[model samples]
Target: MSRPPTVWLTRASMLLVLLAIMLVSGPARAHEFRPALLRLTELADASGQGGGRFDLRLVAPALSTAGAIGEGDLTPIVPAHCELGQLRLDCGSQGLIGELGVAGLDRHPVDVIVELRFVDGTQVTAVLGPDQPTMTLDGTSDGTSGGADNDGVFADYVALGIEHILLGPDHLLFVFGLVLLVRAAGRNTRTLLWTVTAFTLAHSITLAAATLELVHVPGPPVEAGIALSILLLARELACGQTDETARDSPLLSVNESTKVSASGREALARAENSWSWRYPWVVAFGFGLLHGFGFAGALSEVGLPQGQIPLALLGFNVGVELGQLGVVALLLVLLAGGRALAGAVGLSEKTARLATRAPIWAMGGLAFAWTLDRVLGFWG
Candidate 1:
């Protein structure tokens, strides 16, 4: 018996969904190579009148379940200068107090642990808890002393921003989605360049505004929104309707054909067709705004120096852009090389065309899986 058109479509959709799911969730691979390093710097009161004794404690687990941080833990990994409170006395005009250093510790979501104790035995910890009040270390005895210095503070902010984007899975996933979109769309070199540029411009605006306190959007909502963006992209891919140009590309047609066996010839055709120069840039610009806010949240956690907010914001944005560019570069190289090889081998263009569907389906599935996970996480 012949299947109904609707049934066939449903089956096809389901298959596509499954493929996307597998692509994303196939491996429980570690998203980041290394955890963010937690650095604690302490300055003690130089008056020498206050007690030198203070408490040092860590609220979060310092190691993963794999026991990778075994033996040499927070205490040992911490730099020697700050370990014994030497750096505390070295903060120039700022009265040096007791310093405790913790390093090489790993945690998810957030890193960095700090605790302060007074001679009277009163202690403060950086753990986010009701009992432990959050304290802003403003480089002053009164907690509001230092006017934000532009130099050191901005440098730190920029470094942190770069590190956060590099290690952030959500950000990476968003970037990966963009790359897939570009690939599927068969964007030309000019288009790819412009798209990346647009994304950079868009995100940089939000990141700066948000970081500078000019705009304040809550973290949770922004994160949830980011996950939603991923879902939207996945939906687009699964629906198999992006732009008309992307869907009807001749290169894609050749790549999709199962009859193509020559990898070299296939590669060459892909190179020739990969040059659509406008649509992808527009898409990137739109999505880049969402990503920038995401980056802002991470940078804000460390607290930027008011005076150097611009520098820090700029640096952080630069880092994120670099990471995005790196991903795009890799994708271009892989696709270009693959197409070249296929073309040389005289692969059947039809077979090559058919091959493009696998990656699309796989990415869509993964996006769907991530979306589901995020939704459940939010509600559940």
Candidate 2:
């Protein structure tokens, strides 16, 4: 037997309310991997003995006065051979070379981007993590940075990109909404491919453009727009109700050998008439541009490696695509398993339909909450 409509609505409402509360109350930037910046510039000495003033500044984004981001002090570890002065390290004739590390990083696990500029115009940039707190400053002028080589830059960015997508609940929800939209429209695999491809291409363009400074948009508005996009998709999914009474419609004669139900024909006609159903790729592509801006905002937080922007950009974009596809695959598998289990348990069609629609409601509720919070954040 099917569940009462009132019960289904009540359960869905409760779930939506809970999700909204959690999303609205939680720290917005809690999961974001905002990197701290560490810059060191070697000062010129009259004797050219490689001893000069060192400007050590650790800049990291923070929200509250609690946690490692707020309380930890970052001090640069200087070479033992050099005399550590108040602002400069004196290495009388050593040329400012040796092991370099940042103190106070052990207290936190944030990635710190290190930039070393020598008097001879040699510049080296590397990413320092808690696991590997120290780097050997070889004091070389070669293109390779002493700590992070080209390969390391690529890999670090790839990992960062993957981590960003996985940690971003909003982006995942948008993709999930896309999947629901495709399934509701009864789209084939080819259509799904087009939809995903369009989204990827559109976002990649904007991400590159925004990162390269070719395009600039306010981050808060972009965030709100991304949430709005998900809400729009949810609306479309909710509107796609199948009609089972139009049995004799000629729309079913496309295949005479196969049985065509009234509901199937009605669905096809609805799909044909609906712009979202017929051209989902267009919708995805348009919204993807807005989402790309959101991605650029995150990328901007973790400054790009100097002289390797292209490589880092490529790696990050590739990582994002990998993470996105993984989410889609995992969701597909979970949905399949859920359907199989429902069938095994002999669930009523109405109950199953309610379960399917619950996620859509959750997505809409969460997206709405996120949009409202981000928009109000503009004032804050």
Candidate 3:
């Protein structure tokens, strides 16, 4: 009663194509939490308070001239009416007379990149998001300036890093793929731990290098590559392939014990265990390098001050690791909880096992959509 192998392959291919089209042709919701970039210029003006002058530009897709921005919106750098034009929000005057953060940010959550430049050539840059909406602005010539405090350097950047990873769906998807890869290795906690740690270390290396200007790669390509990595994992997951074979993966025994014949299991094991296949951590380390570049590109744009680079980098990397751990832990809990419920309902173990393939397909579909969108974006 089983479908022919060729028929199954054709059907799967058609479904993949359909999924790609359905996801890419529609209005994309890829960036659900894009942050606002705030560029503040401080210069001395004859009509300025204490001879200080400032002008602000806030850029975000949410800022547009078409709609009405109520008082509950993001607060600009200075006290003045905001006018939105073409994804740009502007406020302040030549004379920065009003007090800093007069109204603070609105009730809602907003992410802002605060950049400050003084006449004395000092630069202070920091990320202001929903977690932090306001900061003091001082524009004194020949005066010391700082954006992030030394005390909070580790904590703040850590929080920012965590926030960025959580907000980024692509990154989350990549991590989810990793979970599938590591956990599938007979749920060997040691393998999973090492793979995750290796990934963290690899990305941390490139993230630091890129942020410090030791390395530079376009953000778009890196993002596209991350999506591609997820797709690769999906393929592996679907094929039941890994760095092991029938003789290697502990799962091979489990697969044999199932209703599946030993011959079929052997085929699955040998094909997956082929020398051409990559180890889980090896794949993670490789793709993680690209993902790190993506992270660095974002962090740079988010305005980490040159002086506080080290602390910010550490904190952000830590945050990313924490987020990754959180996700893996959550997945484990859900899987355990689901299995318990399934058993309670008298579901056969073999039937329940079928659900394991869901993540592979879901990841594949989403990754394909993102890949198509990003590739098209290069020209669009």
Candidate 4:
């Protein structure tokens, strides 16, 4: 078979392997909430003295009566604050809330024991719940604790940005394509660095503009365009041609008089492949902007706190960058190891070329499948 034909077949086989791997791995799920938030409020008397009315806000999810209560019983185990025993609990219409008498006002920090028992025989004790911002004794609304002053909107936007990118399937596929294309071209490190930087800059620009209401693009068209971009890229890889002309060019030139040795020809072919190292980066930059807008849309849904927007946005962006780095690192390890193994196996230059090219086709095919699914989702 001709070189291009062989490359196409190899890619098809690899696509099947990737699809199988994804199927067997199963869907990913998030972990449960461990420590709930605990809010401590100081009460004041009419004379401006500290009244011993300690309001404890215990944050726990509401459960149905049919569901298990704390460790099958209503009592929770107390470790330090209370003697080594279980405390009586109250189930309210909203959730369980327990108030303890505050006797000491001189203490800078007070320790309290909080526990929960589930009907399934699960018990949990915590010295403190998740930290919440401090509130003042005065009835006047303070800047802490989900007040109007909170920068919730910005924070939600950033968190949404991170979550959307991490969980997004199409974004993952595009990143994979970037990695595969970089590996195929033999310009791994330089291409990866620049590609990531370019994508970050491009998306951040659009994210800021769109979030601030400085720029607007129709949602449906953007989504459809994003899917189309993926399909075009996949086709480019599958075709194994730089352009339409290259694709249409004859697959091979026959010459009986001067038959190049397989080893020499393979070396030349490998060198030639390096020319396309930047191609994947170009594709990634284009699609990444669209993905960022998708992130913005999800953030809009969650709604951010105006007061805590900075902190929330920081946390969310950190999560996204961490996830993207993780994916890229895994791809690098897998592809790099595979390349080393092929070299170590002492496969002839010709065979190695054919083997490595197989991964590109596989990557492209997967991209195609993903593009089709995404396009259908957009239309439907």
How close is every model to the real structure, measured as TM-score?
0.59, 0.80, 0.73, 0.52
User: Of the candidates shown, which would achieve the greatest TM-score relative to the real structure?
Assistant: 2
The TM-score, computed over Cα atoms with residue i paired to residue i, of candidate 2 is 0.80
The whole-model C-alpha lDDT of candidate 1 against the native structure comes to: 0.50
Model 2 lDDT, full chain set? 0.70
Q: lDDT tens string, model 1, 1-380? A: 99755455446766876855665453322132232232333324466444332233333333343444444454323222223343232333332332233443332233443334343333332322112223334434322222223453444445544555666656666666666666556656666666777878998888888876788887555665676676666555434432221243223333244333345444434533432222556666777787777767655544543334566567656766677677778877777777777677664544444444455555555655655665555565
**What is the per-residue lDDT of model 3 for residues 244-350, given as tens digits with 9 covering 90 to 100?**
22322211234343455566576567545842134788877888887788777666655565566787788878988898888778876776677667657764333
Candidate 4, residues 1-380: lDDT per residue as tens digits? 46765466456667676875466223211111112223333334476543433344443322212322233222222112222112222322212222222222112122222322333233222232113212212122332122323244334334444545655655666666666555544464777867765666566656656765678876655555655565565554444432111111112112335445555455445434543443656656767687667555544432333335455456556556666777888877776676567557655444454554455555555555545554565666
Clashing pairs in 3: 244-273
Of models 2 and 3, which has the larger TM-score? 2
**Candidate with best lDDT:** 2
Instruction: Count backbone clashes in candidate 4.
Output: 27
Candidate 2 local lDDT, residue 372: 81
Off by over 4 Å in 3: 1-33, 44-50, 61-108, 121-126, 136-148, 241-259, 271-278
What TM-score does candidate 1 get on C-alpha atoms? 0.59
